[model samples]
Target: MDVSARWDNACRASLFGSFSLSGPDGAHIPISSNKARALLAMLCVAPQEAMERDHVSKLLWPGRFQAQARASLRQCLLILDRALEPQNITMLEPSHTMLAIEPSIVRSDFEELIEALNDLRIQEACSLLATIGNKPLLDQMDFGDQFRAWLKIQRKHVEGQLQIAVSRALVALDRDGDMDGHAQLSEAWLACGRADARHWDGKIRIAVLPFEQRDAVGGPFFLAEGVVEELVSRLSGVSALAVVARASVASVANSGRTIPALASALNVSHLVEGSVDRFPDSIRITLRLLDGPTGVQIWSHRYDGTLEGAMKSRPHIGANIIAGLCKAIGVEAHTRAARTMTASREAYSLYLQGRALTYRAIGDGVLDKAIELLEQALELDPDFAECWTALAEAHVNTIVFTPQLDRVERSQRMADCAARAIELDSRQGHAHSMRGIHEWTLGNPLGALDHAYEAYRLEPNNADVTARLGSFLLYIGHTQAALPYVEEAIEQDPVYGRNFAMLCAAHFNLENYDAALAAGQRMIDLGMPGMWLAVIEAALGDNEKAVETYFRQRLLMNSVILPPAGLAPMDDDARDAYWTIASRGICSGMEDDRAIYCQILDGLHLAMPDPCDASIALPAIWMGHAELVMKLYRKQIHPANMLGLMSLWTDVDPIRQTRLHPSFLSFADDIGLVAAWEKYGWPDLFPRSSHID
Candidate 1:
């Protein structure tokens, strides 16, 4: 037996003993059987601490009866004891204990490698990690058939670490030397002819599939979403990886698309697929990775963990899968086994609910529901910066345009929420963007720009961050700087509406209204709200048509607010906005009865820019309740959400209505003036495009 070691170079070492392993002095011993020699190697490199008794039974006895199992376990232990005598190593008898046997002494190559890595010796970590590279583990496994779940877990953990160490080594080599050294270092990692380590290069495309419906599917199904979400969260945490976000990949699960098709559609080189199943006090999961384009099966495994006590510790299952897949792919897994953020199952469950609602159609009470769930997430994890940002955004969406709360009150609340989130963790781009928006719209533009820029810098890869910041910049009138960010945002996410408006607005302010109008037209074509489109078209010298489009949008807005006549899905907020605007005409006091499916504009409170509640009261004559209309406004009814006020006396007779409430007579002048203008055929607000042509 020979024991040899060199830190920088490959060392020649011999597993010496009576038969398998021996002492540093090269002592000798003799084991009668080869199976005993093999078992020693097996237990020696069990990856983790120890191999237990049941594992030995499953390995050799496999499907054999009671006598065969007992005999095999006894023979294996006796052989292990004899072979390891030289090294003073001994296997726990029957080998059925919880921990594996640890060698008493070693000249083993692995010992030195472990010592070096533990010493923070980079050179040793690399050389040692490289020594164990994908060489055969237990080349003569007399027990290959015994791959138990516990053994599988240990293998996964070690493999994950090996890949991470390999990647780290490659990185150190790259930083310390020339390209050749980096190339050679990378080449050295080519175990089994693939660089499949979990070292996620930023250039690699990644596609995250939607989590399996843990709850939707039933009992354990609820955990499916959390498993997938936690995995995504962990992968993204590996700073070097260019991991895709759950939101973008959610459409796959949300739309029920097949995994293979999604892989191709998303154009990622790899795919992770899995399902989570649950029983009382236990959770079982199945997962695998595939070569996305080729559909070749890469790796597949199942984990049956007991989530008996803490629900949150369940995310580890997801983390394990990700870490496992990265190991399978040859990427480094730096996952320190810990319960962070959503360590408890309860918090994970709430996080999933919040994520699920994020893409739902905007409606009254919907955003509020999401906010509630996110608030719960924050409660579960007060230090979770991501959840804080989500909650902050939910707050913003709640009063985006409620038109009820006072501006100062609402704005202050929004700013405070955004500020607290940013204060907790400024590195979070979403938090930075949220606070930047509050500053830009209600506080200081200069300060807003600084925050927005910081957000972009932090999350350069996220289009949402860029688009949101660009939109905020446009709102604050920083059109020039806004354009490039918006352009990049569009490049990142072509169809999302937020930045499209800002992109168009940039052109609009640049006096390239044609481009702006084209952009707006695209938004309109896609069924998005026409707010920016109308503005862009008007800027492009199409004011007449723009006004027509604007009025049409207002009409739609009004109908949207009307709560739908019969079985209409009035939950859409944009539609609600349109209906509100339509009911309150910009210049016309005259009724567009056809627009509202009515005979005349009866008791519909004609919105007037008066200091009193005369706007609604003046129209009461047609319907007859001046006091009732006054009380409605004073009751703090939101003007933007007046859905069902279509009353009697609703016909066009402003005079008759005003007569009932003399104080409302003043509105008669404005209505009459608007009426005369309509009666005489009102002229266009801007010259026709045809005239310009």
Candidate 2:
């Protein structure tokens, strides 16, 4: 053999799944003798490492006499040489005392896989995994006990490397937003029990169908839906019950599915169906608990009361219905335990009206109207815990919807209302959840998590609570861990757009751009802000889409439209700079502020300046300019006001780079992220593996 041609890329071998050899022209080179193939396999396992001739003989022909084994080994080598010589392949470099496979010509699948993983070539490793499948290493080759032992160790090492590579590949796919690839690999991993189940599949699932409204004269449209919402919220507190969220139930509410079919579609064991009848001054509610599998009515009840009486008697009515359902299902009745608040019928009616508005965005004035009604209800009955919770939510909405408003003041007010609600009724999970949001808005992630977990503990089955907690986890950098919760929440409440918003953020942070775009579009369809979608388009380098989305969103918000005609002719640098300023103006509705808008517009031509001014930092951060945002934080945004840390785990390209920057550790330490991570476990993007001293 011409040993000098060992480095030639003329031939290759595959040792995983099955063994095979191919020459440079892609013709299969047949090695008919079993011992000959075995010799080649051994050499291919570690092409760079030469094996002594005697050792190779003992392993391939164990228990044979030394002379006989040596004779067999030499025959196998001759067979291999004859097979390769036909293709002009020189794959061996043999010495008098040692044998070796040329590292270049005889390169194998196993060898390449290890190298890909070692070099952190995640995409290549993922592609290689398809060829590996589930076959045992060297499955086609028969070997002696000594050789089998060597194969076992080799297989074990290969398994370990593949596991790590697959994991990293999944992360890469997620970051790249390769949903199809992630789904396929995830399915394979799940089949082999490599992936954890998102949630306990054994939990008892139940769906509360939308209540039918049967009124001669139409009352408020929210009345019937509100009843279903209340029941769903109340039932979600029962840890043993996995109550379906309002959105999912609403989706099929009018689907006209039979009871059993509805149950099957929702994957639930029991179904609660009901109808509401509103008369001139009286209301009646009829409910039925059905055996989902058989579609048999297991229990039934009717409650009748005057409008005023119904509003005041709802707690008692809801508790009775819950108690009956729980008993029918063989569970204890824990309905509204420590959850009752308010006696005024009028106050309760106002609370219902106010609470309904918070569920969906109707118009610009909806939140203001909701806040007004909730305040009036509070005045009528000062200690209504649920009303206070609803008010806090409306306030949070105000802060989010109107950026030019005093966010700090509004956030503090929201915190106070949530705190009061908790004080009045400590067991209300929604109240704790609101308080958690307040903590997050104020940039105290650890405190936010503490409250969020408490809310989850209080309402282990609440879909809203689950989704909110998941959103918090994503924002705080636990991208992977947040996935299960987001998925679980969606399963329970698939129609709720806010949960989709959370899903979008999770995918974006994971670098799953396509998936993020899909989720964000879904969010917009469901009547939520398209701001995140615009940002995602920008991250994807789709400047046209991003610009169009920004203008469209501004129009939706009733803000002045800033045309991108100038952006079309600008170079990449100018476009980015213009966008950074434009997005800030659009997002903040600063154009309405006149003076501030002019100041920002004047600086549209300037580069991102050092020591970013505090006023522009928040808007800039939202626009994905985290480098400037971080500089602002380092200079003046920490300790006294920790709001800069709010976007710490954002997935925009610039922001993602910021997290990997060396200064991030110091920023994390200064903002108590390290301490929070230590106590609660590190986030996915910044895992303990990346922890710096």
* TM-score to native of every candidate shown: 0.47, 0.56
The C-alpha stretches of model 1 lying farther than 4 A from their native spots are: 1-202, 214-222, 237-247, 250-253, 256-273, 288-301, 308-320, 323-344, 358-361, 377-384, 401-411, 422-426, 491-495, 510-518, 534-693
Write the residue-wise lDDT of candidate 1 on 433-518 in tens digits: 76765653332445555677788887765666877676655533345666777776654444455555565557665665546655
lDDT (CA) per prediction: 0.49, 0.66
Query: In order, what is each prediction's RMSD in angstroms?
Result: 25.3, 19.7
lDDT of 1 at 455: 82
Give the candidate number with the greatest lDDT: 2
Per-residue error (Å), model 2, residue 85: 55
Candidate 1 structure lDDT: 0.49
Over 4 Å off, model 2: 1-200, 209-226, 247-273, 280-282, 288-300, 305-316, 323-338, 441-443, 511-624, 631-653, 661-663, 669-675, 681-693
Task: Give per-residue CA lDDT, model 2, range 296-359, as digits (tens).
Answer: 7878988888766766667777788888887776565665453565777668668878876765
